[model samples]
Target: MTTCPLCGFEFDGTALSCHASCAFNERCAVICCPNCGYQMVDEQRSVVADRLRRWLARRNPPVREIGEVCALTELRPGQTGRVIEIDAENPVRSERLQVLGFVKDAEVYLLQTKPTYIVRVGFTEVSVEQSIGAGIKVLVG
Candidate 1:
């Protein structure tokens, strides 16, 4: 199950639909926001190559991890961090992360891990995983 990026409502992964005009179909990618209607196109192979070039430009980057920090403690459980990179090879996780606001500079905190990972962003908590979490870059302040 995954949560709607805009509304924060839980849903089955199969229920998500990508925005029209998006290059990839729904099954190949994560669902768009039911509330805000946000969706991202799957990057073409050339796009992936370009992104790889950008990734290579960075020096000594941290390994990507999934999950979030404990809401109460603000410490990462076993899986949680800022999304500094993306592996477009997996479209579902990559698109899902984008939908959930896991982009750079966004703050994510892990709340719980049971049926799924409960994450906190600002005042809202939602369930997600490495598929999306790995792309986020976390910071301690």
Candidate 2:
């Protein structure tokens, strides 16, 4: 079984076998989500990868604290919080942000608000426009 990275739709990996009719199917590494048409690289399964994922999940469980939910833009620079939701008007834009590490339950650090909104999601610092930052809601204690 494979889960769509964007929509969280779980389906048999063979569903992607529809590319059997395509000439480049054998060499193509891209996989598309049937539900939302999101494309991503088809990485092979690895036991080490699975173990690391489990370990990381155990290390950082979901945050359940009762906290204020507000837009990422509302956070003061230097404040840290967990993402609650992204309310972008365009679904594709929301999914793109999710792919860039602003997904629910992930920790985010508001680095700065001036110039462009600079935020740290995991180890990557993402530069988001003010308009887009306003759509990402986070839970701040």
- The per-candidate count of clashes, in order, stands at 11, 0
Off by over 4 Å in 1: 1-81, 130-137
True-structure lDDT of candidate 2: 0.80
Candidate 1, residue 58: the lDDT equals 60
* Candidate 2 regions with alpha-carbon error over 4 angstroms: 1-66
lDDT of 1 by residue, 77-141 (tens): 44345544554567886677677676665666666655555777656677766454444445543
lDDT of each: 0.53, 0.80
Looking at model 1, how many pairs of residues clash?
11
Using alpha carbons, what is the TM-score of model 2? 0.52
Each model's TM-score? 0.34, 0.52
